[model samples]
Target: MKDRFDYGQNPEKTKGGELIAAYLCDPETADAEFLLSKAKYKAITGREQKKNADILCYQIRQSFLPGEITPEDANRIGYEMGMRWTKGKYAFFVATHIDRHHIHNHIYYNSTALDCTRKFRDFIGSARAVRHLSDRICLENGLSYIAHPKLHSKGKFKHYGEWQDDNRPPTFQERLKAQIDSCLAEKPQSMAAFLQAMVSAGYEVKHGRGGVISFRAEGQKRFTRLRSSTLGKGYGQEDIQAVVEGRAASSEGRGAPPRKVNLIIDIQSRMKAGKGPAYERWAKIFNLKQMAATLQYLQESGLLEYEQLEKRATGAADRFHVLSGQIKSIEGAMSVNAELKAAIMDYAKTRPAFKGYEAAKYSKKYLAEHEAEIALYRAAQATFRHVLSGAKLPKMDALKAEYQKLAAEKRAAYRDYRAVRKDMQEVVTAKANIDHLFGLTDTQKNKEQER
Candidate 1:
């Protein structure tokens, strides 16, 4: 139990212990507290709880999808789940670990009741109950949860990372969309030719009532209707007809924005790996389309000249960095302000207890009775000493005003930061595509700039 607690509260995993939270006990001393509870249980019941027969604590691991939750929120969610599960009867601590790609929480709660008169017993279907409770909490916090979870043959669910690794195969609708995209890329001359092209690509096309076109791939049980409602707007019969007649642009018929231009594959390298003429032809066409898109974007952005495009890309990158630094600075100030505010409130609430202890001349009995309050007061004093040094503490109203001002500044900076980041990304991507198309290496680019 101690080993598990140590592992869960590893400083490296929990951001140097910053992401740890406890309820009813100090997290650092929680193991000792649990041991103390066991001793009390033995004294009350006259039964020494054997290590093998007794459960020391329970650990719940709650994981979040990568990038879906922040570490602080994960810790809070874990703490809330523990409180709900234990009903405030147990002491627990939640340690949020961000050492892996996915953020997860490790909650360890004592098995003995807070009063040390009873022990928690595991019941049937408790695992399912925990899962349902976790799902409910996740949804309440606006996080996604698996609605229909599948169990493995062993009657257990796969690990989160394993589930992510086993990416589901593309659905029938997705496969059909890809086939349609490929057929459209060939620029079929007529609807008849388009249907024929699909047939050649291993699809069975059917002309249904009201001129509705349906298609079924090999081994498919049912034919999928190629209607605006079924296959989305761009794959509708009318849209395809317009594209065939050259009445609408191919991109418009596809019902999606143009894909960003990307670097072309190295055909020579691919051919050395045994690619045939058909593959080479496809690669050449793909490269041609990408170059066309690149040129169009350059024309629209007024960056036809390489020098102007390079300069704009550099300026966009610099602006993005400046905005990012500003947001970080504002966020740091807000964190300090929040911490100080909390300390001030804690100090105020515990002031009466500290004064009574002082009046009692720091009597042992008084100190024992008011231990928690005195500890809180001392913590707040330490915080003030560290944060304010010798300076006078600011008023709560002043701190609140400062925090609000910093938050407003952060919001404004964040908006500009997002805009600058997007601009930087687009400009940088365009510059990279241009370099790849022109076969310009970094050394060559530097030489050209010098020239």
Candidate 2:
């Protein structure tokens, strides 16, 4: 809680916390006050407060497009959103941070009620409700909200950076469709001629059993069936045959955009896979073209020397591992924190039932009455005993703080993770291409000797 509030209240980010506005709590003392409410709840109910009992507070981040709203206005809007959402039943503070190009608010509200008797229960569709509220508040303050939100099929929302990467390299199926379209454009007179055109364009065509046609692109392990089921409508084998026989118009203007660089082919590996002289020739030419592209990529990246390229590839790979390790470590801590929190909450909720059963002198009737609760209580106790192992159970505030800190670190690391992963892929691909071009592998060297 302190970490979150402090980050937002960074002197550099929020102009020494001047942009902070609080209701029913001081910004500096909010964390303490929030913790006190939890304490009060425990005292009032005689139920132990567990690290994972109910949420101590909820945070909502409201961000404005660069230069869209002033820091003060952003804070006010955030404050309004919190007040309206909680209906002033909970205490909250809004801290507007202007550290990035976007001005965003960190609104933290205590989950425990002002009276400390009940917690603000999060309901289904709370996210949507808050979004709607935020949008309404934004409009009332003369700010814009997302008028049309795009839905992801997987139910995971994409961040701006992820959306920016949508224009990536086409998939294998898309490339094949494009290739088939290119073959059709040649106006082949027969299916045989169309297959020949595909071969000329570096595809290996196979006439399978039952007249099934398939094509394998360079570096592809499996042949893709030329069927409507696989390639979608209008690009099937029958569709191509129809176009070839002039029975139907060709599917026009479909192909992958030219790629900036292509990976080098493993010619020796292809030959060992029973490729003929024709395939060997095509493979050599493909390798040469791709090697040139790789060289250009290296030159542009300032890795002209083979040693420099190797060093870069190794460094990129190492850096990727380090970032991955950091993320994994953070995730591991988070998992433990979450598990402990849930266990604590379970223990606290079932403690009363277990106590009542004990008071009944271990009677089977009482046990039968509260079997589920008593069992859950025992399980939680066992978990604490196993995990803590005589160590003191950390305070709920400390655990929350640790989890928040870890979460922040994870987010920061993930941003670097994406960039480092991209760098590693490019540098590693460049190195592999260089190795293939020079026939650095033993198999390639043997092929060279045989020739």
Candidate 3:
């Protein structure tokens, strides 16, 4: 049975309450607010308590396989997952809707904690945590779980959302890549010939210092670099030359499948199926090495046990949020400083016109001739009236210095933010890897339970 889970924050508390009320009104569902206490009033309380919290509520959807789960069972699973994940910190409401062929649960939880001390942080991999918990719950209840093979693959790959939508027109790079591939397929005699063919295809090519080639497709915003890294290695200069001179075949059809991260090797299961004694020995050694590596990682992180690892992970997540808040505060200050500096400079620059108009008032002919100047001066005065509020505009130099100070502060904050963010990612990744290993072990245990 395949299950899908996705969540998004609700910025408006009233709107979130309305959404929950609407879901509860669904005809197929009864006892909509299952396992919830004062669900209707929590949204109001959440808004009253946390005035600055943008994410007042989080809307979560848990969809189950069609006909696999009844509405009652789905509601139970949803409530269990919600309570388990929230840890009684946040108030939540769950509604089961069988409006479609499949049974799905709509859950809305308050962002603020019950004690009004902490807020629910939707940190990195938090969604995956929900999914993992949900899957485990499904396995416990004798229901099948969908395995996401793509997620298990190695490297930073494009997710389902990141993939190019077929409904939209081809991307600039895609079109250019296709054109380049087409040119290469014809087998040009030289690199120049390939360039000529690209030009004939209505592409504007510019060759720069150090063999840097850039192409500007028609109606494209900016020129795209034709470097080996930008395009695939097969479209590089050497590859192009090889194709042109008929020395080498095109590697387009020969691209290898993406390598997977097989850190959690199920060698024992493979050996148990029909492997030899040598394979068993190797598997034993591999498992021992992995266990040692895990222990070393925990030791370095000062986390001796699983509970300590969990606490450390939470601290890392909190640190990331703190760093993010600092960066945002710095950026906001910098923007305000920049805007103030620009306004001050503009007022100062218009002062000369105001002085010129005042001096020219003695000459009636000059006043009539330079009416535009007087109008500009009046406009500047009006702007300064609104901006400075009866006070004189500050000197441009002082405003500039303030802006520079803010800019420097922002830069320093950003540098620190980057370092903290990197550390947070490392901690989060280590936690995720450990969780994945534990998940694999849980799957094995589940299989044993099934047998």
Best by TM-score: 1
| Candidate 2: stretches off by over 4 Å | 153-155, 159-172, 178-189, 195-451
Q: How should the candidates be ordered by lDDT, best one leading?
A: 1, 2, 3
lDDT of 1 at 243: 78
* lDDT tens readout by residue for model 1, 1-451: 7788889999999999999999998888888999999898787546687878779899999999999999999999999999999999899999999999999999899998886756887974588778899999999999987765765534488876555331223457866876887798899988899999999998999888998899998768999998788878677788878878988766435456655655556679889999898667657756666677678778878997999999998899889888888887998888789889989987998899999999999999999877767877898999999999989999999999999999899889977887887778777767876887787758776454322
Window of ten residues with lowest summed lDDT in model 3: 1-10
Model 3: per-residue lDDT, tens digit, 314-409?
787788788788777876666655656655554465567667767876577766655444554565566667666887667768777877887887
What candidate 3 gets wrong by more than 4 Å, as runs, is 1-52, 149-451
Q: Tell me the whole-model lDDT of each prediction, alpha carbons only.
A: 0.83, 0.80, 0.62
lDDT of 3 at 89: 68
Better-scoring candidate (TM-score), 1 or 3: 1
List where candidate 1 sits over 4 angstroms from the true fold.
1-231, 238-256, 261-293, 360-366, 441-451
Worst 10 residues of 2 by lDDT: 253-262
TM-score against native, each model: 0.52, 0.44, 0.32
Please report how far candidate 1 places residue 251 from its true position, in Å. Answer: 4.7
Candidate 2 local lDDT, 1-451, one digit each (tens): 8887777678898878788899999988888999998887787556656787557789998888898998888888888888999999899988889889999988899988786656887874577778899999887878888864553534467776555342333456777886787788889888888888889988998889999999998878999999999988888888888888888876663433333455566678779999898667656656655676677778779997888988898898889999999998998899788778978987889899999998999999998877767877887889889888989998778889999999999999999998998888777776777775676757764453222
